[model samples]
Target chain A: MRILPRTAESGSYAALAGLAPKRRPSLTPYYFILPYLVFFVLFRLGPSLAGLGIAFTNWQAVGTPRFVGFANFEAMARDPRLGDAFQNTVFFVLLTVPTLIVLSLALALFLNQPRRGRAVGRVVVFMPYVIMSTVVGVLWTWILDKDFGLLNVYLNFFGIANVPWLVSESTAMYGIILTTVWWTVGYDMVLFLAGLQDIPHELYEAARIDGARAWGVFRFVTLPLLAPTTFLVLMLTIINSFQVFDQVYVMTSGGPGTATLTLVQYIYTTSFQFQKFGYGSAVALILFGILVIVAFFQIRGYRRGLKGVE
Target chain B: MSRTISRAAWYVLLAVVVALVLAPALWMLSTSIKPEREIITTQIRWIPQNFTVEHFQAIVQNYPMMQWLFNSLFTATAATLLVLVLDSMAGYAFARMEFRGRGLLFMIVLSMLFVPIQITVVPLFILFSRLGLTDTYWALILPVGANVTGVFLMRQFFLSIPGELEEAARVDGASAFRVFWSVVLPLARPALTAVAIITFLSTWNSFFWPLIVTRSDSVRTLPVGIAQFLSLRAGMVQGQMSIGQSMAGAVFAALPPIIIFVILQRYFIEGISRTGIKG
Candidate 1:
């Protein structure tokens, strides 16, 4: 009960009123934020700048680092593996994002209705999201194991041939995508659910009064109103897709042939596994560039979509 | 009549989706308890032919499962506590305290969110190694604590708090610390819980950094341990117990977060809705 203090009194208006006579600008604020700021400066701000600096050097976790301007970037541009890594990462994103958008929205739409077991359905869908990526990778690898995996076992039972889910280069990416969808679709669904709940009930009522049926109501009323959330989901999914590492690491280890090797996994191997720190940092910089550009456009779309809604 | 039929279809569809979502985890659980001989048999069995906790017992006995579990729990709990304290303070400062460069500082913190931590991995690893802190618990807790998401969450929550109560507290001769400690934080429990659940789950489930930093079996977290166990099995050492034990490791590694999610389901959902992203 002590922990649950009355929240009614702590509004912004109360906070504004709380400022008494401006006691001479003491270092109170600085003190309050110092602990967080220290760590942030050391870990985040410093590392980010250092990453940029290290990308221009040939620091291989040994001897005094020597600078090699753009050599790392130059080498990366010529590296076929880097190209494969980018291709696989984008392919993974393309496979996951659109399906996530359509499916999660559909789910949110269904769950928004007054249905029996709605809450349970929401919980069940989101369950995988909370589990560790490592666990998901392990479980799915077992399930999708080519010879003795459960999935093949089931397929064989259905009189279909084994699909070689994570084994074949062609199917490996799809296997990762399927696992990615099952693992993360719930997150996008929850966001959409929130967006769905935010749309005023009266908007739907107005559509109903206009004799709009289910599809009409959704297309005309719900979809337009949910644009902001949709845009946000798209942006987030793209960022997450680009940064995918854990599941790929555990499931395939960049694979039977570098089939599932993603940008992050590539950076991991190049830097840590192969001791190519400078080149890896350059690859990371490329990833950072891609993410920034995607975020820029998505944010612009978000604003434009919002204005249209208004 | 059509509406009724559609409703029935929706219910059926939901049942199917739920089963699909639950199946893999359920399969993991089933595999964890099944004897090794039956696990990879020709036929798929949802129910283990022979149910046994022997795999769990074997892994726990053979590997440092308890050590990894304890490392995860200890680090996650410590990180959560530290985050609550540091983030609440920083959040209060950003939201309420008037200071020079405050906007600039807060913007710097906010922008950090967009910079993927993976981008910083090499530098951070080098930095930690130089400081001789690699493979230590501080290696995980410190950087993870440094993340600005919790600070942002706290700031947004604290922004909604009105100034009136704090003014009254000041009128009663309470200091700024006292006001925040006694008046603000208690009322901020919902936000605190949301941040705590998120921080704990993230720290516990985090894999990438721990994987790179901890080169030894002694300091690795549960996820790292489970992943290593898996890779070892993937090397095909040919033990009857390997597959089941690997499944058991996964089950144990996933247990804390799952239990935490079930208990703090509302807060977890709330945190997601607030952030508008989950990564």
Candidate 2:
């Protein structure tokens, strides 16, 4: 874990310069990594660092950002819109993550078994993941279209009344969640399937021979083995749910009156639509901070679970 | 026996799950082929009564679907190739090279992965505007020339490459680059292919950046074009007929990713599965 290379290695690199020894490996790495490094710095690093500065300024997208140290953050502390975005974002994370986790796990477990037509089922389940969020938004808009939506149509077929799916604030978030779950669960399922594959069959057989019930085997063998995949999926689901912008932008446009305006969509609208770059950076910074916290916990949880380390 | 009933229940439950998953996709296809009137009709039909290829034909007739296809192909392929070559070299250097600040530089490089594409959008737009590179290929390609995921993957791959082979090459008087090309590159095919497929798909499926960067249809790629066409309908089914025509367009949009995924499935899954290392 030494940060720098040994002096002996450094001298060797110098001596082996002309000979171009692969072991000494030249300054070639710097030359090689330059393209990606340059772009990464220019695009990802530059904007992020600039945005960090903007969080403390009064940038308005068109002019010089006057330094207003912590004013944006202070404004964000009392901003009603940010509060709503945060509330809605938290609700979305809470709502979508659990549903996606349970449903995807159930689907994955179902497909994990050697059943008939499992391959067809898996591929079919995975199809929605391939479509664009815009398309998913559009398709679901029609399907949940209050007047002509297939759901309302089906409900009527069963003697139910017409329900405004996306028009109502209460139902709108549900519509987004439903669309997201159906469209996304397959990806988590695929990850789970890979995890399920890694679980040795003989372990199940051994448990079966020892007179363990199906539930017992799943609890003891399957769950423990699949925890890593589940953890990864949970991590993804939480990140995705928090950063839920596309569906909001596409489906409801963050309405029926700001019911589904997620943190990301809010940040997006703040900068682009409202052109409040400084406040937007504050929002972005808050999101960044929240993600960092979530990531820290997730990493800690993963390591503690995997290595039993504190 | 209860076994028969249980089996039937499992099948039925799975049937429902499959239906839920495929319904939107099938709906997309169904709408794409449906004739104009049928789409607007109050009638709710799972399968279209009258299907036509009009939408596909319309795209072919009025729009530069072919040009869009070519742009997507050219950009994705070129970007994938560039990422592969550049990423692999950098990966090898970082993993194997004994140099100053190598580890620190790599940590910095990889840290860029945490910065979501959205954070970069506004500044990049400004930067590209200043460079007057907007609407051009550089606007599209240059910014993504070196992806962090590709570098991370390639570096991991290089670490796994046997140090003895590298030492053997040096012992045999082979140049560093020579050993990399001859010994390292060939052996890193599986990793390279994984990197290639993932890179290709990401580039192909890239949306916000391409939409922001490209000014007109001549440069606009499939995702943006499809978004434009879809959004023109403005989240409505105005131009759509019988769901079949729109379905056809949806199918067309999703086809390349499917074909590529199927062709390079092993690499595709591996690449995706590994790309979540931070997660």
> How high is the CA lDDT of each candidate model?
0.84, 0.74
Candidate 2's DockQ is 0.40
TM-score of each: 0.93, 0.88
Q: How well does candidate 1 score on lDDT at residue B259?
A: 87
Docking class of 1: medium
Best by DockQ: 1
Show the lowest summed lDDT stretch of 10 residues, model 2 chain B.
B232-241
Compose the digit string of candidate 2's lDDT tens values, residues A206-264: 99999999999999888887778888788778877777876677677788888888888
Name the runs in model 1 displaced over 4 angstroms: A1-23, B232-241, B277-279
Assess candidate 2 and give its lDDT: 0.74
DockQ of each: 0.49, 0.40
